[model samples]
Target: MQKLQFPAWLKAAYGRCPDAIPRGLQSETIAVEDACTRVTSEPVRACNAVPPWSVAARNGYAFRTEDTNPVPGSRPSKLNSDSDLLAPGRRIDDPRIEPLEPGTAIGMNAYGPLPVNADAVVPDDIATALDAIQYKRVLVRRLLPRGANVIQKASEYAAGDVLLQKGQRITPERQAVLIAAGVRELKVSKRPRIGVVVSSYERCAPLGSRSCWQTPDACGPYIRTLIEQWGFEVAQIEYISPPSRAGSTPQALHEAEISYRRRMIELAQRYDLIIGSGMLSTESHRRVGLNGLSWFAASSSNDEINISQGPGSRFNLAVSRDRSPPRTEKFEVKDATGRVRESHSIHHFDRATFVNLPGFLSSVTVLMHVLVRRIIDLYEFVETPGPCWEIGELARDVECDRKTNLMQWAKIVWGPRGEPLIDPLPDQEPHRVSAFLDADVIAAIPVCRGGLAAGSRIHFLRLDPMRQPAAPNCAIPQPIEIITEAHHSTEFESMQPQMNIAQSWSCLNAWLQSMPDAIPGGFRAAASDDDIHVLEAAISAKLPADFTASLKTHNGQVDQDGVCFEGESLLNIKGILSEWTCWRDVIANDEFEGITSDPDGGVKDDWYNLKWIPITRNGMGDSLCLDLDPAPGGTFGQVIRVWHDDERRERVAASFEAWLCRMVMDITGLEEQKEQKEQE
Candidate 1:
């Protein structure tokens, strides 16, 4: 039988990829107004305070705290807008308020400055306004509260405060904030230029004439859109293809590689990061098959996790290529460190990493998105932290393109004591909520599933090693199986889910073992302390014999920090509470009688004393009542809804799409359609 092994030539090329480009200058300056999407080079602080002067907080008046208050049965006092008679103690700079009789009148304008210790009375209280000048001062009202109707200096942002942080991409809101903080312009990191290398030439030309097909320029524009979505300001994108004359000649391929490399080198100097499309492949010509585009086939190593791990020994081991191909292992390559001095020839390794991913264009789109985003983060020397509670199943579902199954997913982001930090959609909200989950048919399944699932293994080893796993996701254990509704006599029939589970678990268990430094016996460590407890509970669940033993042998310690298992959760509400800072009071307090739905109805209905439980954690609070048109339902002329955590909201959206795709797949029965059409 022919061995299922990667090509030797592909392996050597990948083993020598470059670690990073040689240092080069690619400087350019863009106008601040034209710099949207550019990464910020440095932190931005406020140039000056907002509202440089003490401005009116409300249109009613501006005044000092100390003012005149009307005393019972005393002589009345009359005051005018510009006169100092309204001053406290009848003294302009006095600290205490002067006592006056109940019948008193005063006047003031909203922005007019108050004399020291002199307060101004608003028109609504002293006199009703017919126009700007005609304030008819009536009578002295109730006692005025201290510190009312005044805005202190520096109430808004103060000068020198950091308005935007370094490394943050500029957004409209950020721009507005900077402007509010008195920034007229900003210095930001230049958006990186991209150089694309596509191999569109034909392998053989007909009678010295070139093939009509052009490399699909579709990728070029699509890439632009994707980068913009990632929130980067793209400076430029340039497309360069292999020479059209290089077909059917040995020199043709070599020349193409060299020419493209030269162009990339030049572009690299002008770009912060150079991103190329396609051309990391073994094939001389483009192939339509998905397998033909796989990263593994094109390059020769599994470097996804390595790029994300950081600059450490673990990362080095992940990308190492000195070892020989592994024997009897699913993922194995030659090690990268040891050099073979065969006679006069010595081989030296290159330092860059190569990633091979086999998928359809749509799936590739998502994968590239994840890859580029993570890469940019890595290039900046930061390991982007994973979400507190990732929707692993949903992420898998989306990756597998099983869109319809995602409708059932839901996760809550909460504070300690079950208090929700995000608002949930109110029941009366006019939108359907749903979730989604899916199974990974490829890669590792846990061994607890059993059988081919139990003993199956895959590995990734440096070099063309004989004992490493074949690929990242290959050799997954089968899905878990449980005996449900089976007859007392039929053992296999009784446990469908259990049987599947055993198969998946065994496969995954064997596969993970091939990987180095995994929890001994195919177990992994938990992500957090809380995960340690949940890991035990999950392992204790009824699983396949082989899978259970693997767990038992590993002592329930798995690489929880690496990836979470099905039942384990990593979020800690306590951490969020400890990190809590300031919050704005976005509450409303108003006595509401129902207002007429129709403008023509002059009569106002008594405001409904709607008894709504405050969305509270501490004390009583309220939401202001605003006039709104009610739908046909008599239920709550008012509406209330809660907030959703970010991750949960993203999952719910992804799940809904997955669910739709699953429904379509079910109805089409695509394989059956393909067969039927073929028979015709």
Candidate 2:
């Protein structure tokens, strides 16, 4: 199997941060009123045309150009020589508004549409006939322009202009634009839901029963509070206690690993990500926290952790997972002395991501912020902002011990002049906790090395990563959804919408039904219960319901000549088996490695994990499949397309049904295809 790899540069930067999380939810829509400050998960468009119909721009008198012409100001009330004037009993020929004879004027309020057959509005300022209109005589003024003082249809925008785009944060201004475009609702990313697992050295008798001895505060609550400020949903804090505290037996301690493992799995089902604290360090002899995670993955070597562990080595050991037992009876553990220490149990994890951070209140806060912030960015597939490292001049001399020890992150704060200033926080010492409490940002100094002059520009992040300016809902290349009611109605009219999914699917399916030969072999018939069970066993995963529904209709295959998707054959059960087996063998033989942590790629690492199941392949060897294992914070049952040559994967849609809808839309166009069919 190919070895999963992370770019050396990124690994260095991430420190102990894991690569990816599993997905548990999908994008959802909420009313615009409820979406302010939320990030959009998908692009939204104008539903109706702006200025649905032509209307008056301001209060004015409505009339045709010919009616505004001079007609001998002194002409008799009953008749004129030219007879181009209103002759009292004559009927107007247009149906738009109440018909009136030529020279008869119609009054219009601001923003009102002109009466039928009327092409222009003469504003009170421009009419010049306010006093002479009661009688038949008309005043002569400069010829008025047609279409004057009127708002034309589609003046602001057509029916399908994009109003909101994916990854854009909604603001009041954007809300106004959405309202104008008839967007009453929008799709937005859900907040990250976290399952926190904290390890206590000892278990308490019961909740709120501990003696009130004055001791330092626990860091868990503070971490929880800080994360909440980031707009994430924080689940109840779950504590993993040592076996002695729980049952007081060797067997109980031994069983702790299994119990916590079960808990982690259970938590995984409900949370986007799981965080374990104090597991890496010793916690009451029960292997409940980090040790349990390592054993679950059966890891063998921890090179990455060793490098990032820095100065602390006595209690630190990297745990890796292995599918088989070690060859030697004694396992080698890398130590701070640059040598291996032999031990019975090995430390390392391969699949499970674990990071060891000091439990110091300040230390934990800094690390947690970095780790959580990165994960949030990754979950939404957004650009992970980098640290704003700059040369910072220390206001005072920062000093540290000479012995190489734990990495000390000094607090940083913005100076009076908006300059970044670094403040020294005591290293691994509790008495100097004041430095942490008063600080706003943090900067790390080299382990075992510390002595700085007052003036120095040191590397640091803004506590938060540096954010680059981005255009939000400004210009979009293609509109995925549009609100037509906003565009079709007058200023007073609003479009009432149900949803867009049915319409998109109905349109695509209607076109497909029109062309019987669109799919290869005319689409296969639905599979039986026995067939579905067999297929599920063969793939080792329950198929997405929507995908299975489509398969029952066709089984994704082609036995005949004609095809639908660029001559690519949808894999039948047999074809799917063949491809799956080939991949298994390749992975077994170390010929094809799956995934480590890939966030930069549109497709996340979960697609390459064992949980993902392949569904189809193209003639080019590229495969399209379903992600059974999504990131802890990702949407499951999502479709991913993996390219043949580079193994680059791209997430296409949230579910099989959505994927099919997108496929039809992509093959044609999301809205344009339907618009065309409607036109036909």
Candidate 3:
């Protein structure tokens, strides 16, 4: 019944694995073009300097800087010119070309290496040619400063400079830089091989099969795909079917244990990591006679290590085999004197990391994202933690046992104040694989007594498949301050009844004018009564009093500033009407007729309700609307989100006035914070 905190468990888990790029992981030289996403095994240095010699940056005449006066309106500087002008592709060392003299100039094409002694170039537009009896003279009207219009030698990078450090992944941008630095090949770590093991008591069936009591392996293929996406190769996906007999006899259990151990040993010899999902509980381990296994015995107090996160609470981390002969590998390292020295690196291999995960699909997903992904990142030498975490406010109260950390799948919706609201999905019962279908992010709720209440700030990791690891400076968010409605009421009362919509509009407009950068495109002219009436007639919905007054003050933004609200553009009368008509058309066509709204929120059940009028857009086919027709137990005139691609509609505010009041308070509160910081 004892639980090991996640951080301590993670530390212990890391101790079992080898340092990054173990000796067993051999290095291979690959073409620079094929090095994207591969970690460098050794530091890569530039083979040659970029722009080996000074070159003209533009089509111009190259000449010495001292030969001409750089002041304006001065007599044109005269310089002797060769009969045959220098062109691109002509070698600067050609024997036919004379050395550039102080008073002589040479016509050179862009990117052409400068002739000897030429320090600057005059663009062709400012230089003219004059015919003379002895030789042609170039009369440059404007003088160019020294090194002007020239790309200096070794400006970008010098030969032997480190282009990429060890353990850095070659991104597309980095690859381009490496190619330009004359790096043709890179020594990168070989992809780590991973093995996925799914343990179950029931008979496994193929997906979509209707056979009796047969179910598909939910964690196998999904885990494989995740590992592959992270650039690791899944060598094999094997299933270990423990004896299904009730109250398994000791002999049967012993036989199952032998089979399981043999399979694990085989996988450990081949793979860098072994991920086992299902049958991680002590009872399950005992039933399979795996209680004697060293890896299973390392669990805290009990056979299972309870990580403070839910559905996936039961977990285990151990090294399958840690005793391996030290292997020595040679590496070319740069010495203090910048000379390459051959050094021997001693490391141990044959120690495959083993991670045991809970059986449920949701648990598998949570542990994979939070735990397994971290393991892969360490193995692959991923510098940044990847674009994983996003900040949002909890949409509603989430109750938990408070004994462990909770991992909840949530759908993201933008609030009226432009803050992201995390709406937890209903089907959190570990077995519901469908819970992940519509989930946008996985909210990591820290261990707390009464759980997190609505409007509490929390950070969650994104589940976006297309996201690439980036931003080395992205730090993991710290635990949030648990906020309950009762505790928040005091803070809310201090800012209430401050300003009405019309007054707030005036104050906001003044602030915007003071800070032009706040709204790049200024506010549009106020809407006329006729325009408002036209919009009402078009949408066939009456505009709320507060919304109508705000429109009269300013129709909308001139362009999408995304400043009116966090990342939304306030819609004008015409935009509102257009958006309404479009949604109405979608409804008439029955495009999403059977779809329903989120059951927990105060929004109506219909996917595209006719009574919802859009007031702002997030530029991603999602909008914040005024809900004139509210569902049962919902407030009329509430602000809600209507997503074009999702079926969730969430109520954000009680009314337009309430939303504007909060927006104003947020702006003013930020200003106050800034003022205090400046004073400090």
Ten-residue stretch with the least lDDT total in model 3: 484-493
Error of 2 at 625 (Å): 81
lDDT of 1 by residue, 290-331 (tens): 112222112443332222110010111112222233222132
- Candidate 1 vs candidate 3, lDDT winner: 3
Candidate 3 TM-score over all chains jointly: 0.55
Badly placed stretches (over 4 Å) of model 2 are 1-18, 22-26, 36-39, 44-165, 168-182, 189-192, 202-207, 211-217, 245-252, 278-288, 298-358, 385-434, 444-455, 463-680
Instruction: Write one digit per residue (lDDT tens) for candidate 2, span 168-279.
Output: 6566677787887778888887755566656655322234344464232355566667666655668676665533345567777668756766765555546555555543
Error of 1 at 129 (Å): 6.3
* Span of ten consecutive residues with least summed lDDT in model 1: 308-317
Model 3, residue 91: distance off in Å is 5.3
Report, for every candidate in turn, its global Cα lDDT versus the true structure: 0.32, 0.52, 0.69
TM-score for each prediction? 0.39, 0.41, 0.55
Using lDDT, give the best candidate's number.
3
Expressed as tens digits, the lDDT of each residue in 1-680 for candidate 3 is: 11212233245444433332343545799999888778888899998788667788998788888888655334567888874545434444532234586688987889877876788888765565556354478766554668989898889899999988887777678888999888999899776678888776542534544457657776888888887876667766777665455788989876866776677677777876778775645464643422224633223332345555567766665555443666666667888998987665655464666667765778888878866776665666554433345556788898766577677888988665555678888868777879888988887677678877987766677785335434212222454454432111223323443567888887667655544544457678889999999988877878888888889888988875343565577888878887888888888888876777663345667888888999898777899999888876566777887898776676677778777766665543433444458999
